[model samples]
Target: MQPASIDKQINNYLPQVTVNQKKAVLTVVKTFAEQDENEYSEEFKKELDSRYDEYINGGKLVSEQQAKKRIKKIINGKSK
Candidate 1:
């Protein structure tokens, strides 16, 4: 298998989450990390930044319940 595919398989075998969950996490993190602030329109940036408040407070990420809720909301197509 290709390196990328192999890495995906490994991620799928992660202890807790299923393959789809791992893939979704990878896709979101990769996409979000690659985004440029300028790519967002003013309104979208404002809203998203607000929603991310719990994910990042005091410039530190707290990836616990707050983060999980945000992820679920996004996955379910719910807007803030």
Candidate 2:
């Protein structure tokens, strides 16, 4: 069956389902979504690791006061 047909069928039957059944369906959907969320590409992982290494090595480091000033300048549209 097509997705639209399945969706229409689900919508038609949802109102007839018990509250516990609805909660079960919601839990199943959240599990599927969380599985997708945990999958990431190797290249993305490498990039994240590289940024973390730079942070740990103090590369491109800025003081808290300097960071706040830069943020304020950017928010005020005065960043160069």
Please, what are the lDDT tens digits per residue for candidate 1 over residues 1-80? 79999889876677678779878989987888778533878899898988789556655665699999988989889653
Model 1 has an lDDT value of 0.80
> Candidate 2 has what TM-score?
0.57
Instruction: Give each model a TM-score.
Output: 0.27, 0.57
List the candidate 1 regions with Cα displacement exceeding 4 Å: 1-14, 36-80
TM-score of 1: 0.27
lDDT of 2 by residue, 1-80 (tens): 99999999999999999999999999999999999999888899999999999999888988999999999989889644
Clashes in predicted model 2: 0
Total backbone collisions for each predicted model: 0, 0
Worst 10 residues of 1 by lDDT: 54-63
